[model samples]
Target: MRLRSLLFAPGDRPERFEKALASGADAVILDLEDSVAPLNKPKARENVHEFVLHHAGETALLIRINPLTSPEFEDDLAALSGLHPFAIVLPKAEGAASVLKLAGSLASAIPILPIATETPSAIFEIGSYRDVSTSLCGLTWGAEDLPAAMGATTARRTDGRYTPPYELARSLTLFAAHAAAVPAIDTVYPDFRDLNGLRAYVGRARRDGFSGQMAIHPSQVEVINHAFTPDASEIAWAEKVAAAFAARPDAGVIQLDGRMLDLPHLKLAIRILDVAGR
Candidate 1:
């Protein structure tokens, strides 16, 4: 799927689910984890299950289950078994082994999107997913939980950027996703009201090779989508490059618009076309 923006909706709030669907996000994440309180976990799961049963084939749906170690994990899995979301977002994932363990438990073939570096162990094991790429759809990281897990006073800098350690974690997650041959999804922007900041952050993520971003609110979806989609100029350039390469397949390197284009540049041009088509 062309996942430029994946928006979140609290699973317990079924009233908001339809609104989230209409928010223009490429995917919707029904959150049954941190968004729901301990007492409300069961109800949240039910709401999500019902919603999925009714709308499973309509839109790309994802469920964010609580961490496997939490009391709610098994119930979450049991409740969601037959509904079959597009993918499950496993929080606090420490490595590929964790993903494999979950995949082994599932009765169906559901791809996984792991929050790969939300803990110290997760950061250390980022490279482990390279071997488990078949079952993984993407790799994402969360800053809010990791810093708390690490006992850090702050996850963000005074200038609103991620702290240095968190920045490293984000970079590692991006690299791990690429190594695993899956999309790299940036974490939520947090400040739903800061559209300018969200745009800048999404632009930076796209520039850094991230395929998409998570949105905490519906308002952020459009910004993320626009930031990731190939613009008119980009599409034009990709088309020209592709045509030039096709015309001279025998030449390993060809001159395009006075610039020497090599195999790697041609490959990138093709990728841009693929993404634009998506």
Candidate 2:
């Protein structure tokens, strides 16, 4: 799957499910955790179950279940029985242990995308994701939940940039995903109305090696997709680097455009080509 943009839709709002899929996100996350009220969770799960039954494999569909510690987690699994989403999005995931816990609970083996840094303890366990990387589709983190768990006032500064601690969380998630050889998915940009700000955010994310980003609103989907997609210049450069290495198969280092390039450059070029679907 491309996974350039994964939009979240409330599981209870089945009316908007089709709308979300039509919004051009690579995937739609049917959220049964934070978005649905406690009293509405059962109904939400039913809605998600019904939707998944009809629409499974129609698109990249991910269902964000409640945390492993929550009582609703079992019900979430129960509702998803005999159904397969593209992946299961696990919130407040601590590490490999959490991934294994969810994996063991499921009747079938399903890919997981864990929200890796929602609690203070999760930060220390970031590196542990490499152990259960095979069970994951990607790694993502949230700034909003971590601050609330820490009793903080906010995760970001007045300028809408992440504070130092939250920045650490984001960086850890990014590096951990790379360490596991999985795509690092950036968390949702909360200010859905700020298109310019979202564009800048996507630039920083792409620069920092996040292959994709989460979207809370439909308007952000096109922006994320356009920004994350490799442009003509990038594709040309990557092709040149790839062709240079291809010609000198035995050479670990080669000259490309008068600059010395190495195996890492070739690997990156291959990744670019893969992302571009070339």
Candidate 3:
């Protein structure tokens, strides 16, 4: 449940699955969707199914299946019928309706982790996701597919920051996940070689309240995990806040580090501790 970094590996390559699983990611997602070409989808699904059936992982194991709109959707579901993954990642998910419809094809109650923003119309459908919160493992979004769907050249500006529209979409995804009471997982950073950039990117994500981030490469695992994990200062502050609340259970507000601390602040401190797995 502590999803600091969810790493993705193409399902077609069974050889790389073990490597990815051992990459120290909080979770490993075997991707059967965009990563697999149309001609390779069947083999990829087989590889994923076989791998899931035979292997045991310390971290969560997930499969990213093609969208409901894809002709391969049902086939993808069929491969997972007898096997249980930690969760299934549904790409190009618009809203609860589409996800719920896809649920009929699945054989188990395995949690769903959907990429909620893909199409132009999907932007308006986030509100409906709140209804399916209990069924969700987390809510994530991707920048690549959405822009492609809109016929845009890129989701980012020349400076490597998200453009206004993509930024809004990212914020909406974050808000929707929190409003739905699920973890807000940020999308992957394309520049895997740029560890400094990955650190800054994931640091910003944590600052903005995203619970976790996705990684497309193994080298990113350490940086993503470190970025999301609570450091010494954060843990120490949370400890003090918790102690303050414990000392004055009936107090409506308290002072900490020369600042006013309220119930909300106490709650956040507790969350930091919880997230840190203390």
User: Across residues 1-278, which tens digit of lDDT does each residue of candidate 1 receive?
Assistant: 88889999998889999999999999999999998888888899889999998898877999999888888889988988788788999999989899988898788989999998777888899999988999988989999888898789999888789888999999999999999989999999999999998888999999999999999999999899999999999989988988898998798999988999899888888888889983
Could you tell me every candidate's TM-score relative to the true structure? 0.97, 0.97, 0.97
- Cα lDDT, model 2, residue 29: 98
Best by lDDT: 2
Q: Please list the residue runs of candidate 3 whose C-alpha ends up more than 4 Å from where it truly belongs after superposition.
A: none
Candidate 3 vs. true structure, TM-score = 0.97
Please, what is the whole-model Cα lDDT of each candidate in the order they appear? 0.91, 0.94, 0.90
Candidate 2 Cα errors over 4 Å, as ranges: none
lDDT of 3: 0.90
- Give model 3 RMSD, 1 decimal: 1.1
Model 2 C-alpha RMSD to native = 1.0
Whichever of 1 and 2 has more lDDT, that candidate is 2
lDDT over C-alpha atoms for residue 85 of model 1:
87
Tens digits of per-residue lDDT for model 2, 26-78:
99999999989999999999999999999997879999999999988889989
After best superposition, candidate 1 residue 196: deviation in angstroms?
0.5
